[model samples]
Target: MTGNTNSIENAGDPPRRDQSEPRRVHITRGLVDVLLELAEENEPSEMNVVLDATPASSFDATFDLDPETPILTHFYLPSAGQSVRKVFGVDLGTPAGRGRARFLTHPQGPFKLTERDDFAAVVLLAVPPWDDDTLGAFDRSGRKLELVVVDAEPPVEEL
Candidate 1:
């Protein structure tokens, strides 16, 4: 018991963590870098600018695309619902993808992320069954694009 306290050999008993788990989590820092890189290559605009967001519950937003930027989409948490999901957005003059937006925390949402918008962060989503999608640059004309997916098969109408 006279060895270094930080010794890996000791490997003190692990502490128990809270039972809470994230429903819809954001991309990790490592993945974020890769995402940005992909976004950069397609850079929807000539300006070197990064966008910041504070996503809200039951909310939707649009991002203006630049010519040289790239974008992607994806979905996780297989236990959610079985909806014919789809991602919608401007097609940057190239029909690489489409623009569709839906709530991530719906009773019929694509992922089992109900009651947990706090941990949700925006990232590229995948198409239905594929569970993820990605796009490069915004549509031409600088029009804002929205991300759309089906939370439920029939799509729960937002009140």
Candidate 2:
């Protein structure tokens, strides 16, 4: 079974996982809050985040199927005086169908929620209806949102 490590194999073909099998990537309470907050602000026309679970956690989760379905997860936030933080799981749908967006950050020091910059907040909104009028809302907002548009497709890996 020896082969070139870097050669272009049918690596694109990802083996499927049994639906009955339980998944390991459980969405934490924090993740749910982030997703919900973003969704409320965006109000996407369709789906939200897309999670592609695969047997190979590293590089075998991109295989496509008929209209991908999204897995929903919820979170709770306690510090902000809120009872819970709600965030959706993942969207396995197609580009033409549902959309996806995400905000991710890291906990530092003692995992205190008070620290504003303790987490690197990133929001990736996948809008299937990517139109000027739709996207313009964010672009023409009076509030300042720090965003950097990367020209190249950023590397896809679960952190």
Candidate 3:
């Protein structure tokens, strides 16, 4: 799949870090497509995709996809749960049995994700439902997907 390298921030002084300010993160279409493909290939009972600011800090959304549609969809931040469901539609949580995706925040300070960061990598952890759990179910298994945002290709201005 072709990836788009669009920098989320413009050339200027970086924004000051303030806990009071709300930060917006951008997930590329390419990254979403890759996750979709992975879900289609390996049908897991539950999937956890986390967008983490640091190893210990993050926010996440989880979905229970056992039913024809998701039986339950939750978010670490209650405020974002509904909007995320609406935005992604049912496609995101359908393939995996009961998917759980999360966006993590910093452990100590406020959310530290900034445009200056090289790229944000999403870590996916897949597990089977308790009913299907086996001896090795406790084993930790997952994939780390990286998204690199470049500034070389900017959008053309309309005439």
Candidate 2 — what's its lDDT?
0.29
Residue 78 deviation, candidate 1, in Å? 20
Ten-residue region with minimum lDDT total, candidate 2: 132-141
Write the residue-wise lDDT of candidate 1 on 43-107 in tens digits. Answer: 33221122222232222333333322222222222222324232343223221332222222122
Write one digit per residue (lDDT tens) for candidate 2, span 1-159. 367544457467575677455322222233344454554455532322332221222223342322232222322221232223233433223233322223322212211122232121222222323321122101111222323221222125455
Q: What is the lDDT of residue 133 in candidate 3?
A: 18
Lowest summed lDDT over 10 consecutive residues: which window, candidate 3?
Answer: 130-139
- Evaluated against the true structure, the overall lDDT of model 3 is 0.29
Would you list the rank order by TM-score, best first? 3, 2, 1
lDDT of each: 0.29, 0.29, 0.29
Give the alpha carbon lDDT tens digit for every residue of 1-159 in model 3. Answer: 235334444335575577444332223333434444443444532233433121111213222222122111122222335566788664443334322334322222222333322222222222222111110101112223222221121122256
Clashes of 1: 45
**Alpha-carbon TM-score of each model against the true structure:** 0.17, 0.20, 0.21
